[model samples]
Target: MKKREVLLLAFAEHPEQREKCWISLSECNFSCKGCAALSKKERSRLISSKDLAYLVFKSSRYFWGKIIKIAVITGDEITLNPESLLSLISNLKDYSVKYFELSTNSFMIDEDLLKELIKLKLPILVKMDLKAYDEKIYKEYSGKSEVRVDESLNLFEGIDRRAKLIIKNWKIRYLTINPILTSK
Candidate 1:
């Protein structure tokens, strides 16, 4: 499938550190209730992965006088477009980014995409937001079925096992499940 155009919602340096930056992407696969991305009204024009990388690099240099060492790729559902995400990461690496942290809902990740992500050879910390453990609660909160999350979790486990046996020094930390607990 052709890569979708990336709709950049925001780009800014970390509140406490200039060497870190956040790249927020627009749109999502899931319509989770009370999602922060839902409150973001302004969005940049759709751009290609290469252009987005250049813009990020330029913005970093303009604001901090240097390229950011760490990039946090966060959005409503960053994995919605796997090709675009991979392309963006590849382009960012070209600018010599030291590390990447991807915060996602973990609904769109599949085995193929996971393999591609493993091939990146960069240290990536995946922060997966688990909406809820109960199927009914998950569906109610995210407007999506929980089966996808289970699939993703299984994929992460399988990859982790394979990495341990095949690649002794895997850089990707796999999945860090962060459940979003809410009081009803």
Candidate 2:
């Protein structure tokens, strides 16, 4: 059977007052309770890397002279589809994209993935979510252990030539805090 693939597009505000066209892939490892996006049960079609890159290249033309600031690739968990995701990003290097942003939860990032990303040498920004500071809260919300979060963050920070590596905190719309935890 073929792997499931999806690309959701939208426009959003990027850092430094730039506007970016956002593309999101679906299916995630974690199903955080408050997430607004639909569940992973939704089906998706398969798209090849060349076709994906072509879509982004064509999308850039809509802005004309205004330089399409960046192409933001996000998802329920893009890191889960490392090969496809990287392939698409790598192929976009020749397009008008000035930068590429990959938004992920950091759970799927291992040392190997980090090494591969560094090797790509694409102007990429990683928007990662820390979720929660406490292990219990993190597990409660994201249904996963927090071990990989710190491990991934530390690995990303340890990159020797890290001028290109950016560790970012993702935004959460609503967070319910436990009074006991909040009081501490």
Candidate 3:
């Protein structure tokens, strides 16, 4: 399926993390002042989910069976286009990816989306950055007063029996708490 939202596709080498395939989606929901992605002067083009999946599978072969340790789905916030993420991931069912690490702000995911992710039946690593535990700090950084950190955590817990693999085996990993620092 062709999607007009997905922007760029690239590969990187992380010694500690091994080879990785990075997909950058455009349009973020956050208004963080110091966001590096938003500050960049680059623009990416739209591509189909089939193309993205093909590239991911080919990227693994490029490593000569080294195993693409991680297939990272990141952008301003991938959850903004959950359909695209799910489409791309569903197409990746034939590959031998060790893990699919979704780096998100954890502000957009809810019960329905989590349930769809569980349907994928692939090992998932949610690298969520809890911007702040304090409401004042969160509002200052993310520019949103909703402060959904706790609510998002509860949503993850709401995943049904199908997602036992994620919760019971400890596949879900929360990232460090690093709020977007600004001079505001």
Off by over 4 Å in 3: 1-8, 13-18, 38-40, 63-69, 158-184
Cα-based lDDT for every prediction? 0.71, 0.67, 0.66
All candidates in order of lDDT, best leading: 1, 2, 3
Residue 89 shift from truth in candidate 1, angstroms: 0.2
Candidate 2 segments whose C-alpha is farther than 4 A from its true place = 1-4, 12-19, 38-44, 63-67, 160-184
- Tell me which residue pairs clash in candidate 1: none
Relative to the true structure, candidate 1 reaches a TM of: 0.76
Which candidate number would show the highest lDDT if scored against the true structure?
Answer: 1
Q: After superposition, how far is residue 26 of candidate 2 from its true place, in Å?
A: 0.5
Candidate 2 residue pairs that clash: none
Candidate 1 shows a clash count of 0
RMSD of 2: 10.1
Residue lDDT tens for model 2, 1-184: 1232553556544345565667666678987888865324443445666776676566555544344567778878888867877777777776656788888999998888888888987777787877889999999999998998888888876554334444354321111111121101
lDDT of 1 by residue, 1-184 (tens): 3333333424344444536666766667887888776324533345667877887788777766888788888866788788899999999999988898888888888889889989999888887789998999999999999998889878877443322222233222112112222111
Question: Pick by TM-score: which candidate is best?
Answer: 1
Candidates 1 and 3 compared: the better one by TM-score is 1
Model 1 spans with C-alpha error above 4 angstroms: 1-18, 38-42, 158-184
